[model samples]
Each structure stands twice: as C-alpha cells, then as structure tokens.
Target: MLAFPRPASSAFYRPDIDGLRAIAVLSVIAYHIGVPGLPGGFVGVDIFFVLSGFLISGLLRQELLATGSLGFAAFFARRIRRLGPALMLVTLVTLLAGYMVLLPDAANTLGREARAVVTLSANHHFMKHAFDYFNTATDLKPLLHTWSLAVEEQYYLLWPLLMLGAYRAGGGEKALRPTLLAVLLLSFAACLSLSYSDMPKAFYLMPARAWEFAAGGLLAWLPLRHSRSAWHANALAGGGLAILLCSIVLLDEHSMVFPGWVVLLPVCGTLLVLAAGGLDPHHAPGRLLGSRWFTALGLLSYSWYLWHQPLLALGRYYDVGQRDLLRDFLLGGVLALFLAWLTYCLVEQPVRQRRWRCFATDKSTLWAGLAMSVLVWLVASAAMYMPKKYPWPGYQAILQVKQDQAQLPPGCDMPERGVPLSPQASCRIGPAHAPLQLLAWGDSHTDHAMPMYQLLAQAQGVGILRRAYHGCPPLVDAVPVGEGKVRSWCLNHSRAVMAELASLSRSGLHGVLMNVRWNGYTALPVAGSASITGLAQADAQGNVAVAGAMLAGVGQLDRAHSLQVMAASLDRVASQLAALRLKLVLLAPEPEMPLSVPECLARRGAAACHASRADVDRQRAAILPILQQVASRHANVRVWDPIARFCDAQTCYAAAAGVVRYQDQNHLTASMSRTLQADFAPLFSWARQP
Candidate 1:
C-alpha cells in the first residue's frame, strides 16, 4: 500500500477505522433520538472522543519526534484546511435554517448557539444552562449537541501546546510517557470525583473529559516508544474488544456517570486494538475492528458526526411535542448518510487534498476565517439578548439586583411561616403609593412571570413586588431541586413568604396580587430527560396528604397570633403607603403549553399553541381544582383569570385588540398586559385603597 499523505505519515487509509466511526455514530444517534434498547448509546460519542485524541495526538507527536521545532503554523493550516471548509458550510446552512424556521425565542436561542459555535464555547454555555437541561425554556435549542465540538476544539487548543512544551522542556519523547500519565491520572480522578458528586458537571466539564483523550494520546505514543510481543498485542486487543462489547450490551441506564470511569472500558479497548496493529491480519480481535467495512465508516466519520446531530435535532424540532423514537432514529440514519455523502464530496475530499492550498498557506486566509467567525458570533449574541427596559423608569435600578434565589425553595418544609409569600427576588413595583400592588414570586417561575405582572401593575395602579428564588417553588408542596441540602432553604423561604402574607393582610393594604404557574408540583417538564418511576403528582396520595398539612398550617395563623408581626410591619410601611387598605388578589396564571414554547413555536402550521377556548377550558379544568382551592383559602382573594377575560368562545390569543397577547405560553407580553388593563383596570376602580 502506498503511503497516503496524512500529516503524521504518508500512511494508507485505514478501513476498520471507519467501522469504529460507524459504531460511534450509530450509538450516539440511537442514544439521542431516544431509541429503545440502547440507553448507553451516548457512549458512542465517547468513542469518538477517544479516537480523536489518539489520531490528533498521534500526528502531533510524530511530527515533534521527527523534527526538533514543530511546524505549528503548517500543522494548524492543515487542520483548518481539512476541517474548516466542511464545518463552515454546515454552520452557514444551519444558521440560515435557523433564521427561517425557528420561533423568535428559538431563533434567539439558535443565535446564542451560533455565537457559541463560532467562539467555540458551547460547552460553557450548555454547562451554565445545565440545570434545566430540557426545561420548557430550552427544549428546542438545535445547537445543544455542539457542546461536543466545543470539547474537541478545547482539547485541540490546549493539548498541542502541552505536548510540544513537554517534549521541549523535558527528555523529549522518552520522558513524555510519565508526564502524560500523571496528567491523565489527575484528570481521570477529577472526573471520578465529579461523577460521584455533581452529575451535570461531570457530564459537561473539560476536566472530566481529559482522561478519555489522554487515553488515546497514550495509545498513539505507546508502540513507537516501546516494543511489545505479538502475543501481548493480541491479548490486549481481544480483552479491549471484550470490554467494549460488554459495556454496550451489558450496561444499563443505572450507571449514567459515564465517560468518567466507565469510559476506561472503551478507551482501553481501542488502545488494545491499536496496539495490536503490529500483528497478522488474521489475528482475532484486530481483524474485526480493522475490517474493510469498519474502515470505510471511519474514513467518513468526521462527515458523519457533523451530519448526525443536526439531523436528529431537526427531526425532534419538527416533531416538537411528539416523540417518535423509532422514526427519528430511522430519519436520523438516512439524513446522516445523505449529509455524509455531500460533505465527503463537497468538503472532505477537496479540502483534505489541499485543492485550495492557496488559502491554506496564506495567513490572511485563516485570519479571515477567524475574523468572520468572531464578527458573526458578536452579531448573533447581540440578536439573542435584547436588554429589558423597565416600564417604570425609576424601578430599573431596584430590579437590577440579580436574584440568586430565583427558583423554588428546596423542600418546602418551613413550619414557622403562617402566611404565604412567593420567594420572588428583587422587584420594584410601582411607587409605594401605586393603588394596586401586585406581587410576583416563586422560583424562576416567578422570575419569568414578572413581565406580565409588571404590565398588569403599571396599567392597573398595581405595584409589582418581585421576589423569586431559583429552584425554590412558591408552593409549600414543591420539592427542592435535588436532595437534602436544598430542603432547609425551601423551608426558610416558604416561611418568609408566609410571614409576609400575614403582615400584608393586616396592613389594610390594597389587594395583594399573586401569580405563579404551579404545574410542576403535579407535572414534570415534558422532556424525556427527567424520568422518575413514581413521581408524586398533585393528587397522589402522599402529595395530597402533604398539601392538606400545608393548608392546615396556614389556616392555623389567626389574627391574634399575627397581631404583633403585622403591627411591626404596619408601623414600618405606614409612612410608605400611610394607612391604605390592602386588597389581596390571586392572579390566575395562564396555562402553559403541554410542551416547551420553542417546541410549540417550532410548529410550522396551526397545531402551534393557539390554544382555543376549548383547550383553555380543558387546561383550566385540570388545574382549577388546585387553583380554586388555594384561592378559596386566602382571605379576600379575588380571581384575575386571564382565561375568563381573554378567551371569548373560540380562542385565547395574541390578537386581543391592538395587543400581541403572548410572547409565548403562560407569559404575557408587556404590551398585551397593558392592553388587557384597558378592559380589566376598571374592575379595580371600586377600590378605596391608595
């Protein structure tokens, strides 16, 4: 076989490598599209991670050993020459598709993703938004999977210099082994530690990812550094293959903390196979992975990886709320094959052959790619984040304090709080004298609802006092985000909200308005990522008992018990509002779409969340039982149901006379809330309070 020109060597194209690529690609596809019977399929990407480290490090290491001072510029030029053309073509098409098909918010999200993609920081973005992996807020984000590419790029940026520095600073190739081993061990240990403690961190962070790549690096460097017997290589290959097979077939969903320690199985497996390359073709395990068909897929693997995620994400994007695992998998495979063919022809072959060598050699050319990518990233970021303008000018400073506790209280166990207060964070409602003061509070549920509350308050003399805790629910029934540590915060915040309510009730204040979209106490976000064998729903026996106890606790707070607390609060606020009668109203939160808004918005046609009156009726009926019960218990509470006011026989919608009602489900646009006030504010005209 003639040595084909790979940067590392003029070596013949390895066929079985494609087989490994096929294995990796298929596994990731199966895993992501929610195909049954392959829960561990995500490990396929781990396979790619290992392979990439080995190949990239192999090339770099070979050059370093062959030449004293590495040709870093040529090395980078070759990478850009090889990977850039295909990547740019794909990204441009994806961005174009984003502009057309995506919803406004989805477009914003894709814009952010575009920014992250161009900047190569998608891993960090995903990690920050990791808490709600598929929250209603982010379910339709098409570029979510680009985190892997970010990881690869991150590894590429750091690893080359580290290897080069190690080679130069120490005993060259001979001393390189221990340095790599130590770094690998440290990274692997970090992964192991995070896996046991923080699942999300382990899943996304770079430290946790280093070992897999290092395992590959070590494998690539091994054979040249030391000689091993044919029997040793064969046994290594066979054992490694067995480990890989066992992991895919035998492992279940129970051990999801993978690519941490569990990744060793496959990384070691690949290592064994590569190490065995010095053997005869008939050598058992070596021959299998090295087979002609396997190598073909390996050859096309880069194109395949580029093709698969977009196909799968797009398929899910189109499907929206509906999950069709099998169909998505099938479509994913077909689209991948199609894309891989196109990429191989249009990008991979031409670029790899340096047909456009003129651009590759010119520093200005690479600089152009970088400059364009950065400019696009900046523009996309600007598009995604439109700064919020406060309706009331002076309130901006008050609302600007970023709320850390922006979600639900952890376990909702506070026994001390009698009246309920939403754990809503810093909110600047209308001036202290605003006759109508509406309070929006909860977890981020509270945070997201603030715009609607503000619009309503501004028009209705309703002052909006915003307080939201992240992961802390407004409901005493709401559980903490994860486990025990959160329970204390949940209890304390609930206690605070309850105490605030008691004080307000006694202050003779204008009606207190409250809003929270309390579904998760009974419902989970629609994404399949959140799985529970027996999540206690609202009507669940255990949940009902808990709710009953919570109500009983609130009911126990009589005027006599709250007198001292209320008097102190009244004294403090008397000068602020000066003896104005306080009215309490429970704002009936609009119903959310059964699916995420992006998922709903991504709908091309009428099945989009244009919830007809019938749909509102059904939703209201489902949650009415809980909503009314809560409202009924509160003293002097009035219902501000958007359904009753906004829906008129046919549909509850954005076209509510001169106002665009919804930015998305369950949240009203600022303008819509103001418009609705035109109709509803007169109802508050009867109030004698401030």
Candidate 2:
C-alpha cells in the first residue's frame, strides 16, 4: 500500500481537490436530472465522504501538531460558518416555494423534512420513514439530498473530539493511525453485513459510512514519498478517473447491493486521486483538474448542490409533460447555476467575510445561525398548517366527502393486514339486534365497500359480519405469493377467514359477499411458466399460436392459470356455503381509474378525471369473463356488475354527480361507495323477504 504523506505545518490550497468537488457535484446533479449514461452518478456522495475525511482530518492533525491541542469551539464555529449560511438560505427558499406550489399533503411532508434537515437528523428521519433513496417518489422530496449533509455534519461533531483524545494519548499520531484503521475495518464489516439485511441502515446510518471517512483520515496521517516519475503519477490519477467513470457508467439505483462492498469502487478511486495529486501536483491529471473552468465550478458546487434539487422537485411537482422533459432539464440546470452564483456571492461570501461584524464572534454567529434556522422552521410549520386554517373550496369539498364516507358501522376499522386477527373477531354493520344476514370476505376491495354494505344492511334491517384481509384473496387454496414466496400473513389470514365463514354460516348467515382485486392474481406469471413480459409481448403481437405453445410447454392451460385456480377455489367455497343453505354474491370488479381521482380533480378538474372507455374495457376484459364463469357454475352464486353505474359507452367517470368516485386508482371512496347502495336494492330485498 502506498503511504500518504503527513501534512506540513501550513495548509496549502489544492485547486485539483476543488476540481474533484466539481466532478462530484456535477455527477449528482446529472443523475438527479435523469441524464443518460450516468446511472451510478450517485456514488459522487461516496467521493464527497472520502474527500471530507481527508481534508477535515488533515486540518485537525495540523492543529494538533502545531498547538499540541485541538480547539473544539473554534473548529465547530468554523464549520457553522462554512456550511450554515447557504444551507439556511436554500432551506428557507425551498420551503417557501413548496408552500406556494405543493398540495396539502405534500406541503406538510415538506415541512417535516425541512425541520429534520435543520436539526441535522434528516438521514434518521428518512430511514425511519423507509424512504428508499433510489425510489421514484424520492424525486418529489426537495430536501432528500440533505441526508448526506446531515451525515457529514454529524461526523464533524464527533470526529474532532475523538482526534483530540487520540492526539493526547501516548505516541500521538502512532496511536491514532491504528485506532482509525480499526474503526475503518469494523465499519466496513458492519456495512457489508447490514447492506443485505437492512439496506436503510447501510445507506443512511453513520456507523456503516464511517469507514470511508476513516480511510481518508488514515491517508492524511500516512507518510508519502515524492516520486519524480511523471508516468507513475499520471497512471495512478488516470486509473482512479477510469474507475470513477466506470462506476458512473455501469452501476445504477437498481443495484440492490449498494453502499456495501460496491462502494469501494468510488471510495478507493477517490483515495488514489487524492494521494496522487498530493504527491505530484504538476502531473497531467492534476493540471486537468486544476483548470480554470473546473476550479470555478468547484467554488460554486456547494450552492449549486443545494439549489438544483428543489428546482427539479418543484418542476416535477407541476407534472411537466413528457415531451418537455429534456427542455425542463436544461432550464433547471441553467436556473441552478444562476441561483448558485447569486447565493455564493450574496450569502456565503458575505457571511464568511464577517461583513456584519456585530455578530461576527464565534459564539454570536453560532447562536445567530441557530436562531435563523429556528425561524425558518417556524415559518415552515405555519405554512404546513395553512391548508387546515384556510382550506381551498375544492379541498374542503373532498374532505367533507371523505368524512361522510368514513361513517362506517361499528368495528369497521379493523387492524391492518399482517396483524393477527382472531377467527371470531368480526365487524357487525347494521341493526344491533338483527341476526347476521350477510357475511363479506376478501381483501381491501371488500373494505372499500363497507359504507355501501352498511347502507344496504340498515335499509333492509339486516346485519353484515365483515371480515377482510387486504392483499389476500377470498380463495382458500390460492395464497398470495410474490417474488416466488408465499406470503405467510396472507396465507394465515385466508385460513382464518375460512374458519370464520364456516362458524358464521352455522349462526344464521344468509349470504357471503366475495370482493377482491382480481386482476392482481391474474396478472402474475404462472408458476414454472414463461415470464409475464415475454407472454405479454407475444399476446400483444396477436401471436396466439406462439403464446399457446409457450403456455402448453409450461403445462399450463393459459397465462392466467393462477386466476383459474383462484376461481376454482372460489367455486369450492361457494358450494360449501350453498350446502349450509347460504347464498353467494361475487361482486364484479369496478372500473379502475387511470389516475388518482382527488389529485386529478384538484389539478385538472372533473372533466379530465374520467378514464377513456377503451382503458376501462382493457382493465375489465380479462377478469370479467372469469367472474362470469364462476357465477354460472354455481346455482346459488349471483354476480353483481356495477360498471354501468359509474361508466358509460364513452368513458368511466372518476367523479359522478359532482362527487369523486374513487379514493385512488382501484378503490371506491367511502362517499362514492355509499352512493351505489341503490344498486344493491335487489340483494337487500332478498334478505328482507326472509
């Protein structure tokens, strides 16, 4: 291993280091903007981590060697000055923009994120929320990038103190090197172990990331020999750059095993560049990095990093047209540069120069900075609460609709899926003294119709025993499976529902209502069959023979064999219910909206909320025939199709008669479900006859 030389008494400015910063910041920006050929540009953060460790450790080591002590207060004050001003300005600006443009839920989330960012706990907050850094939803969060800043700030708090202790111990630098090396090894081991099991910890937590920083600190302490060979210096620097380029081009957000062993590519590459540049600044690589443009970009990198994300997030929030994506990217890039330059000149430079000398003292600046952050937090909090205090008419209408929809009968809010519910635990909706006239069972689709079921039960003076397990179908034999594993919770819930239905039938249950998102099971690739994508492509091209052959080769009747199995299981369940003298009603799947109803209404109005008939037909085609087939096979089974109530020949209305029909894409809102109570009059009349 090549040993890095210890720093001299005076610290010299390295333009090449700034040039590396330029590369780091630009790569991050490019990735955020969805630039092609730079899928792993996010590794720039790892580069920043290494650079921070080296630079900050070198400064601390120099202080210790010169004064034989470390000044904690002074060091902390310097950090606050260096990082606080631009961060505060950017956060405040971003919050203000969010308040002006974002919807209520999004604005509230932004406020919470802003508070987390100011406290330097954004990483923990994101980890607690299970916010995957690579998820598409992360693009909506303006402050998501600040998680790295929080990690660096947290490191700043503890590292100096640890360095102070190490320097005070016997054999100063000698003891410190070994200690840091141990920490580096332990942290790297923990990262490797945790990345597989708890990726969020590996991604966000300080301990898992400490090794990179330690590598830099160790490099700072190692002795370097100045080599006269130009080829050697160029080779080291060029190799490092090649590794960085390869990482940027090859790896992507979808690579699950990231920030684990894979992180070494960028980390080691950064180390090589730092070491080579330090040993021989006159090398070709050093000259390229120290060029005027690279150094200028390096100077503005910090502010640019802060400015770019919010602009991009806000642009995305507005739902920029797909055709305009490239234009938007270029505009955002330009805006980011303009804002970064302004912030660097106006906020960062002024603060560092101490132009406001009255509050220039270390203690005063720290307190003042804290106060500014607190003020920004208060403003954000106030803005987040604005929707509640002064609600928009459309928003208020939606809220009232949701409120009415939530007026479900007793025990409607059952424990969420995956939680164990007793086989005896049931929600009774309707007249209290009435015997149970109906039993409803399935997944979230059944739960979504609770309001309508309650309405029907009350009108007929009957009771419903509602038992639902979201994500689990009503079929006993067909367990919900994903990624080639049977979901134990779903399987357990299905068995429990079966047991409950049998008990209910003995206690005078008149009928069983089966509702589920049938398409979900049907869409899955058949076990031991061709992949869904391959089957879909073949089917789309109208190659019936090829598709048939593929299915036959797998010993499957059709691509939707899973759905067939589920239908068969339902038939068995219905027969058993009929033996107990109970009727069976299989509610046909509703026409699913293409987008969120409320969001569409709020953004594009009711006219645009209707889904085209072709889209609705496409969604219903596969599942409808299977439901009809099941209904025909059993004498007691009745299929209830509600498509005509919300859809016509032209389009499926997401909002009908001035009321939103869907809570989301697939589920009926409570209010809309209640409106369909009249459609179930026949079922209620049947119950009342008895």
Candidate 3:
C-alpha cells in the first residue's frame, strides 16, 4: 500500500498493464534465483512481448488514423529514448564489474557480449555461440538475459516498417488487423516447426517469436475496451487469470518444448485479460493489479529487469566455499532493487521524460542516444582485447588448468559439436609398430581416462585402439532421443564400433576396455538437472526419428524397462567379446563432482572441492546393478569400480595433494587420469596375456 505520484499518460494508458509488467519481471527474477515451484516463470517474457505489441501498435494506429501517415523518425526516436539509456548504463556497469572480478577469458567474453548489446544483436551473438538458454552454464554469463531485449529491439525494427506499408497500401488504419493476423499465423507456424527440431534457433530468433508480439497487436485493433456488459468482462477476466496461473504452474524447463503450440495458452490468456479491461476498478483482478504497490513496482519494472540478471550472474561467478542459494538471492535482490530505483530516478526518467535540454527535441535526443551508444561500444572494445594485451592476475594457474585437459592423440579426439562419429575410424595410443592388445571405447568418459590407458599401453609394450563419441554410449540399437546432431550420430557410431570390435578380434586384439557416463544416460532429471534417455532403434544411418512426445511422461516403470534394455545391450557386447576369447573390462561410473575442480581450486582449498558421497551413491544406484549383472553373465567380462579410489567414507574428492583431479563437473583432467596407473595396470596385464 505504498503511495507513489502518477506519471503523465495518454487516454489509452492502463495502470493494470503496468501491474502485469510487475508480475512479468518479478517472475523472471524468481526463476533465475532458483525459486522452487515456478519453473515456467520464463513465460513472463511472453507477457512482456504481448504488452509491447499492444502498446506500440496502438500508438502507431492512432498516428495513422489522424495524420494518414506514420512519422518514422518520431517513432524511432521514442524507441531510442525508452530503451537505449538504461541498457547502456547496465552494459557499462556490467563490463566494469566483469573486468574487475571475472577470469580473463570470461571478462573478454563479457566485453564481446557488451559490444553485441550496444549493437542490438546480442541474440544473434548468443545463437552463434550456441548458448543454451536453459543450461546451468548460463548462470555465469552476466549479459545472457539481454538476448530477449535484442529480440524486442529486432522486432521494433521490422514491425514499424510493416505497419507503414499496410497503412499506405490499404489507406489508413483499417488494414492493420489483417496485416497483424498474417504475421501472427506465419510466425506461429515457424515456431511450431522449429521448437523440437531446432530449439536454440526457435528460442533466440525473433522470427519465431514475432507471433507473440503480433498476438498483442491484434488485440489493439479489436473492440475490447468498448464492452457494455460488466458481467461478461468479469467472466473473461476470471478465466484469463485462471489460465495464466495454470500455465505458470504446469510448465517446466526440463521437459517442455517452448514457443510452440503450448505457448498459445499464455498468449491467449493474456489477450483475454486485456480484452476484459482488467484495469477496470470494478473487477477483482483489475483492482489488485491497479493498486498502488503493483503500479509502483510496474513503474520500476524496466530498470529492475536490466539490473537483476547481472547481479545474480556476477554473484555466482565470484562465489566461493559453501553456497547458500536463498541467502544469495535475498542479498542480490536487495542490491538490484536499490540500484534499479536509483537508475529509474537518475537515468530512465530523465531520458524518457525529456527533462534534459539535449533531449528536449526528438532529433537531438536521437543524436545524443547515438553518442552514448558509441561510448559503450568503444569501452567494450577495450575490455574485449585487454586480457590479450596484458597478463591477468593468476595467469599461470589459469594456463595450467587449460593445459590439464585430456590429451587425445591427433585425429583421435571426439568432436564436441558437429561432425558425426565414424565407426570405421580408430586411433592408436602406443607405438605404431606395437601389436594391438586392448581396444578402448565408449563416450567422452573413455576419452577422459585415456591418459591411464596410454600409460598401461606403453608399460605392457602393446597398442590400444581407442574409439569414442561425445555423448553416445556403447549400447547396440539404443540412441539418445532429443534435438541436435547427437541423436543422428549415436546409433551409427555404436554399430560401427561393434563391427570394428569384430574385425579387431580376428586381428589378435586381446581385451576391450570400456567406460561410459552411466548415470548421465540412465537417470531421469533430478534437482533441475537434465538427463538423457535412449530410444531403441536399428537404423544404420541413425535416422530413427523419435517424437519428443514418445519420451514424455516417462514414469518409474518406463525407467525400469530402459534399464532392462541397457543390461541386454551390455550382455550382447560381452557375449561377442567372450566368443572371440577377448577379455572385457567394464569401468564403473566415475565419481562426478558438483563444481569444476580448477574453478574451485583457483580460489579455495582442495577440501572445499569435493562431492558428497551420498549424492554420488544416489546418482549411480540404478546403473550399478545392471553393470554387475552383465559382468556376471560372462567369464571374460569384469566390472571395475572406481568409488574406492576416488572417495573416502564420507566424500568423493575432486583434488588430492595439490593436484586438480577434474577439468569440469564430470570429466577427469589428464594429470589426475595418469595417476590411476595402478588401477589400470591389472587390466593391461590381462590384455597382454596370450
């Protein structure tokens, strides 16, 4: 119930719309702060899109009806005044903070993103870099939230031109609705087509998102505000509130394919509320939204949106030791709100309200905005190249961590992205002239353990032919079901590896060493972490097209069935190796850490970089029995568990005795990988036998 002064507004201005803005911004911040039970709070951006379309399109329609033409310069100037100043301030402050505290490489990335922000192309930049909006890694990127702003800016660029064209072609504002309808339908079609097939494209690109704006614009041209019956308006408003609440509660990031048909629920819900005149003082929703506190929050919404993400991301980037998410959220929230209020009073209101002499005229305001943008671009350019020009603090430690990455011989490393795996290809890790004794194969887990395999190969005086794919497990006819190249590559790669094993058995290969990220592939998403599930298929080209719907609603029964399939696949491989008289060593799942060892070591001691043993046990519980059962079925097959080597009674350590053990959350560094020679020696001894 805080009282605030009213700002100047036209007749069309709805205080309830500002209340809606408050809801959108607050929900987004809550989602980013890891707020429980609001996983789909991201739909708040959809709400903003609708609001923008309604407001902007209504203003343009009014201009066209009165003047019989659009004033392009005035429209663009108003846009620059509203959006540019706050963005520039935020980008500048973010750059300074990033340069002060972030790692050199991270600072340089921030600088590049800053430049992209000023140029209003951050969406394209992030899309090119393949930044997954839903990934946990986004928590470290201070400017990742700017992608939505870029989408809005890009929409502004094209939408006005389209409106002008329709006004001139059809004579005044009459043709505006049909034009918006055409855009809405076409953009929605594109959104549906790409949501499952090309998720990143659908998420970051404006063309796929324009339908949201168009939905709002169509509402502007409709006769919603002139409704005579109060009862009818009340019913529509109630229904819309119910729908919005349902959309927010039901949808979550891990499973939902967004911006598709499912998006219609929120968009239409918002339309209903607007159409019912939710700002009318008579209605409950309207009264709640138009109240003093909500409108005040709505007034500060833009600046809050600009401030919150940077504070949250920067806090995470620099945090050390024991982490408390709720404490951090509260601290960051207080700081962001304080800064947002300051910026609203000092920067946003001045530039937007035309209080300054430089902004007194539209033309002058546009020029001043241009000058501010240039300043940001130049400063950001310096930030981008400064790390390369001068050595940063802790340079040597950063270099060492970079060098600690797994060393695969040339032509042997699996592509992290693009380029499907070739089943016919294999890399030798020992001397070229040595006989092939062990075949090392699996996913990236096999790649991480290669240093140990290499030491064993040289000590045994034998060669190991290694084959690995980034995300593919060595399971017959079981392909990961999802978007991207991984699905298309896994099945074909597995078949090729199986064929190569058959050929190698005839060529005197003595043993096969295998390692896969068993928990990653077998476990369902838990604690907001994404997990992979495999679908059964037999296509040679891995062209098995499984719909996302086929994988949805997978219960415990489905998981049990999947585990049975995985065990059968492992048994089939073991049977093939047993018949060939070759020993099969199945490596158990490596202990995965919650934090990067090198990142943790850079600021804290080794003691703080360990994972809880109970957590690891829970993660691996489902997959271990299947591995053991498969090994028990064949005399030549043996399962080697690394839990004893990597863990004590209570914790699994990420580093030991001054040496970092892991490169990232799940992959072992080469330095640590080489230290496991003893564990691998027995396998090499068996491989070298007869």
Candidate 4:
C-alpha cells in the first residue's frame, strides 16, 4: 500500500498536481464529445473529486491544527470570490439565450429550469422529467450546467460543520485521522449501496458524491509519510495511469455510474499518482506530469470546465456544419481552450492579484450577485406562470409537444376528472328538468366529440349529460393488463357509469352518445408508447411493460390484442341505445388537425414556423381505422369525419375555411369546439330527426 505525506505548509500549491487536473478535465470533455477510445472519459471527474477532497481537506486540517478553529466567514468568502462571478455571468447568458431562442412552451420550461439552477435543484428537475422524456420536450435550458455548481454549493453548506465537529469532539490534531477515516468508510458504504439501488438519483445529486471527496480526505489523513522506491514508483504510476486511461477511454453505455465504487478506478489512480509525488525524477510518467505544459492546463482547468460545455452545447443546438462531428468537436475544443486561457490569464489572475480588490473580496458583492441570480430566476418563473403569452419564436415546433403531451383522453388521472356527481350532489350541463334526458359518456375524446353530440341533442330537442376521463378507455369485456390497481378502479367506475346510463335509458332517455380514443386500446410496445396506454406489451428497451397512454403507441408492436374488450363495450352501449329507441349516432373520428387552432393562427400571422407534412400524415393515420369501423357496423350508428372540410392533398391546416378546429392536440378548446360545430351541425341535425 502507498501513502500521501503532507508537508507542514498551507501554501504548498503544486504545479504537478495542476498537471493532473489537465488529465481529469480533458477526459470529461472527450467522453461527452464521444471521442474514439474515450467512452469512459467521464470518470475523470471522479479523479478530480478525489484530488479536490484531499487538497481541500488538507488545507482545512492545516487551518484547524494551527488556529484551533475554522474560519467559516473567510472560507465562504473565498468560495464566493472563486465561483460567484462566473456563475452569475453564465446564468445571465443562459436567460438571454432562452428569451431569444426557445418557444413559449420551451421558454416556460426554461423559466422553471432557471429557478432549479439558481436554487441548485437542477438534479430534482431532471429526475421528475425522466419518465416523460419521449413525449415531453427535452432540455432547452442553457443553465443546465449549474447542476454541478448546485452539488458543490450543497457540499460547502454542510461539510465545514461536519469537519469542525469532528475536530473539536476529538479534542486534538491526533484525533483527526481516525475521525476522518471512520467518516470516509461510512460514507463510502452508503455511496456503494446507492450506486446499485438508485443509480440515476445517486449520479445526479451530491449525497453519493460526498464519498468521492471522502476518499481524498482519507489520503490526506494517511498515517505514514511518502517513501517510494524507484522501481515501485515507476510500476505503480504506470499501473494507475493505465487504469485512469481505461476509465477515460473505454467505459460506455449505462453499465456503471459516476461517483460510485466504479469511480474508485480513477479516484485511487489519482491517489496513487499522489503517492509517487516524492518519486525519483528519473521515473517516466512523473516527469511527464511534471512537465510545464500539462501543469499550465491543470492550472487553467477550472476555466476550461466552465467554458467547454456551453460552447459545445450552443454548437449542437444550432446543428452547425463542420464536415464530420470530429472536426466540429475539435473546433469547439480549440475555441474552448482559447476562451479558457482568456478567462484564466485575464480575469482570474487579475482578481487574485487584487487588481479588482474592492468588488472581488467584498461581502456585499457576493450578496449582490446572489440577488441578481434570484431576480433572474424569479423573472423566468413569472414568465412560466403564463408562458403562452410570451412571444417566443420556436413555439410552433413545440405546439406538437403540447399536443403530444395529450396523454390519456381527458380526466382519469390521479385526482379523477369528468366524474359524475353523487346523485345527492346536483351538477347540470344545461337547464335542469328538461323535456328529454340526454346522456353523453366516454373519455376526453368524448369531450372533443361533444359539440357534434350537442348539436344532435339540440336539433332533437333533448338534454345532454357528460361523463369521461382522459386516460380511462372504454373497456367492457376484459380487464387491461399492466395497470392492475388502476384497471380495477377504472372498471368499477365504468361499470357504475354504464349502470347509471342503463337506468336513464330505461327511464326513456331520448338519446345516448359516447366517444373515446379507440386506438387507446391497442398500443404496441415499440414505436407507440406515447399514443396509447395500458397495453404496450413491451417498452422502448424491448422490456415487456406498458408505457404511458397516448395516441402514438397504439395497437401492438409484437403480440396482438384483438381488443375484444373495447369492441364489445361499444357494441353493448349501441345495443342499449337501440333497445331504448334512443337516437344513436356515433361520430367517425374527426381528422386530427396538424396544429392546434392557436398554433395555426400564429404561423399564419408570421409569429411561428409550420410543421412538416410527415407530422400531419402520422397524426391522420392514428384515428382513421376506428372512425371507419364505427360508421359501417350498427345501422343506427352514424360516423362523421370532417376531412373534407379541413384537409387537402397539399396539407391539413389546424384552422380551415375560417373554422378554428382544435383547442389543443385533440380536445376542442371549449370555444373552438362549440363554434366550429356549426359547419358540421347539419350531420347531427339530420341524425336526430325523428
């Protein structure tokens, strides 16, 4: 085993250590860029963690031993001096970019993300969006990099107290070693466990990250001093460097996690290199790290890290062409280094030398920067509070995102929607005690099809009752797999609705109308998880599990559902209506508008970009089949597809011939659904004639 020896000096800043910094940061930048033979370059941050823990703990330990107490104010002041300026600058840049580039929906998300970044809660923001990544829009927020700063901020808040308590409770410098060792062991155990149980959470947050810092703490507290043989130093340095290289160049996919036990390769490798610091100058790799060039990059590592991500991210965002990705990555890398050199040589050195001393070290200055960050975050959040009103440019691209987010039909989620009031609880859609009772029951898709039903009811002179939820499909015969608990609740609820409908039908209710996202029943496991629900037999990774309920993932990707359950339910409802001699007319699914009515207006007004023909075709095919089937079967059932009114060979406009067609993806905005039905009112008018 090797050990790290600390000399009794607070100012022992080593240039060779800075060279090691070059190794760690370059590895991370390389891995993110997907450079050849460097798939595991991310592990380099682990190496940095170990180095940081050892170095910072070493400084704090020396401070405590000499002064008998930690300078809490001074420590935080130093941190502010080091981090606050750059962070504030970056947040401003991010907010400015968000305002200029993102759509209203996307900008609203950026606003939410800005608060997370300012508050250091970005890890939580991403975790919540994890399950919704496919249909949900991906990150457009520029401040995403602040997740690391949040981790660091959390660490700074809690770590000093822990160290102070350990030192004071031990009563002397001698007790420091044992206390740190114990803490390291315990923290490492927890980190190891989290690496297995909940890797994503562990990887994203700073809790598991504490152990990487602890590893460095352990090295700083080692009992023995450095004593490396020439042969040993060469062999050990070579072996450790090999492991570091392996971690940087090879690890890929989702096999292991960062800040976990697997991170030990780079962490321990960094420690091993530290062990050889007192080695013979003849040792090869030591001389390599000792070189002036590597040390310069190491000294500049902090600036390099700050500059790289945003630069590359902006290029990727714009999809800039530069031959192949390698050429683009290299160009980005060169630009990053130039900016890093500028920041270090110009900003960092000048500040450290007290050239800008007044603002640089002042308490009020940090407070001001923090206040500015808070103000930006709050402004962004207020914008999010009503994001649609903002005149953001890219919103047309994300209107589909709003539509794609139309999971389930309507209602039917956690708290329940469109449920009927208890019989004792009176709620009416129209005037009470009308001459004819009209009951409308189904999903939000039913809500969208409502205006047509309303027209028919009006022409026939009857009242309308509505009951439906977004995700709850109309299943009559069999229980859906996947949603064991949910299926039970929904089945009981649907049974209750049908039973109530039975009473009304028997009571001589004039008509019964129903509608649903029918393809909601046939979701395939592969390409269709977003469109349909409760039926995807397998997931995106080919695992057998139903994904969310949406229109995109309808029917089967593999094994088939005759969907006998849904078909039977429709037949049963139809038979009931026929028996009651109620006028029964089913709407053939209306063709989906390529854009929501609002988005179409924006594009026409030159406020947004239009979607591709491919998007329209994909949506059009989604509901075509069920619409055809409902029209052909029951003689009393009438299907109505308004494709003729809104679509042409060239395109399907969200609004056509002055008719505003949709509120959102499929639900009619209450106003648009009601008003637009006037043109299609004749079909319902004809259907209800006795």
- Each candidate structure's TM-score, on Cα atoms with residue i matched to residue i, is 0.69, 0.80, 0.85, 0.64
In the range 606-639, model 1's lDDT, one tens digit per residue, is 3455566776676555445544554455434455
Please give the RMSD of candidate 2 to the true structure: 8.1
RMSD per candidate (Å) reads 10.3, 8.1, 4.2, 8.6
Off by over 4 Å in 4: 1-11, 30-45, 129-139, 192-199, 223-227, 253-283, 286-297, 307-339, 359-690
Better of 2 and 3 by lDDT: 3
| lDDT string, candidate 3, 211-317, tens digits | 99999988888764555667777787788877877777788866667766788877887887887773343566777777888887888888888898888888887
For candidate 2, what is the TM-score?
0.80
Evaluate all candidate structures by whole-model CA lDDT and list the values in order.
0.55, 0.73, 0.76, 0.57
- Top TM-score: which candidate number? 3
TM-score of model number 3: 0.85
Worst window of 10 by summed lDDT in candidate 2: 529-538
**Number of backbone collisions per candidate:** 55, 2, 0, 21
Measured with C-alpha atoms, the lDDT of residue 558 in candidate 4 is 16
Task: Provide the lowest-lDDT 10-residue window in model 4.
Answer: 1-10
